[model samples]
Target: MSRLVLLGLWLVCVLASAVAAIWMLIAVLSGSKRAWRLAVAHDPLANAAFGGNEDETISIRAGKAARAGER
Candidate 1:
């Protein structure tokens, strides 16, 4: 009975470890993909995922466009 209990505990530990590792892997992969996309995309702030920036970023380019429009 003790041996069986120990085996069950070991199995549970292994399963928990595997699940944690997989969860971490998914999080890391998703985070890496987001970072890579942000690096390549000039949107900065990851606003593209939301409803902020479509073609141009407001923080960086909005000023220039505003100035051009004023002229």
Candidate 2:
């Protein structure tokens, strides 16, 4: 019974997400240039969470922390 309920919840979530994605895609394709640009703009929080760069700084910091732990 519990498993069935969980499965139903998961299906509902998946369907909702699919609907939202399709809606966004339709909006993007049918909207104006400015509207499309607005939708494509990046979220500041997302950029921050991703560290905003695909560089070696993160690796450098990890290595430094590891070295400190060794001492």
Candidate 3:
């Protein structure tokens, strides 16, 4: 039916766009640029996730305890 054909076309378009977006993300991450560097280095969250600064400590305590409140 015409409706089935239209649905297939729409699905194809959505998949193509998703692939393009993923490629763009991969390209941006692989390149060595100032913006990406700053995004990874200067951003505290990113630094914390990737362990950027050697001097900085990230300690996590689980369960209910007084010492767990320090971090």
Candidate 4:
């Protein structure tokens, strides 16, 4: 019974996410800055998905990696 409840909760989260994604898609298409900010969600993959510059992201990551090695 607990497993079934967990599955139901998971499904609810999935549906909510899907709805949010669709809303974001509409907002993004309309060029809403707020929507873009929410879409980024401070995630590299999210930024990349929304047309962030790949070269810049790569250079930033590389610089961080290099700095870490120096520490």
Candidate 5:
């Protein structure tokens, strides 16, 4: 009876280890895919072509003042 209990415990440990390994692999794959997408989506030339210049300034305070004057 003691030997059977030991065997059952060992089997449970192995199954738990396998589940943990699979979960880690899935997490790593998802994070890598997200990093790849972010790297590909941020091109300065593409942003400029779409009139999204980083150097242009549209201040929040100025916008709020204009809106207040309009009202």
Candidate 6:
């Protein structure tokens, strides 16, 4: 009788783990898609905040400065 109870508890734990893993996977995939959309839209602020390129490269900064000089 105790063996049956243990088996049932084990099964419940396994199912719960599987459900949690699936939920986490879905959340990650959804977030990645949203980030991709934001990148494709060229949202510099959002991209810099979430995508980890907070500092602009020297060349990019130079280009922007040059463009400003043109105006």
User: Which lDDT tens digits does candidate 3 get at residues 1-71?
Assistant: 69999999989968975775566567577773544644443344434556544434232212223365632
lDDT of each: 0.60, 0.59, 0.54, 0.68, 0.57, 0.59
Better of 3 and 6 by lDDT: 6
> Local error of candidate 5 at 13, Å?
0.5
lDDT of 1 by residue, 19-42 (tens): 755665675677756444434443
TM-score of each model, in listed order:
0.41, 0.42, 0.40, 0.51, 0.41, 0.41
Clashes of 6: 0
Minimum summed lDDT over a 10-residue window in model 6 is located at 38-47
Q: Using alpha carbons, what is the TM-score of model 4?
A: 0.51
lDDT score of model 5?
0.57
Give the lDDT of residue 41 in candidate 4.
Answer: 51
- Candidate 1 Cα misplacement greater than 4 A, ranges: 32-71
Which candidate leads in lDDT?
A: 4
Q: Say what the RMSD of model 2 is.
A: 9.7
Candidate 4 clashing pairs, residues 3+ apart or interchain: none
The regions of model 5 sitting more than 4 angstroms off are 32-71
Model 2 C-alpha lDDT per residue in residues 4-62, reported as the tens digit of each score: 99999989968975775676677777874554544444343234456644343444545
Q: What's the distance in Å from true for residue 11, model 3?
A: 0.5
List CA RMSD, all candidates: 16.0, 9.7, 12.6, 7.9, 19.9, 15.9
lDDT for each residue of candidate 5 in 1-71, tens digit (9 for 90 to 100): 69999999989968975775565567567775554444333344345445656443234334655889941
Candidate 3 residue spans exceeding 4 A from truth: 32-71
Query: Candidate 2 regions off by >4 Å?
Result: 32-71
Question: Each model's number of backbone clashes?
Answer: 0, 0, 0, 0, 0, 0
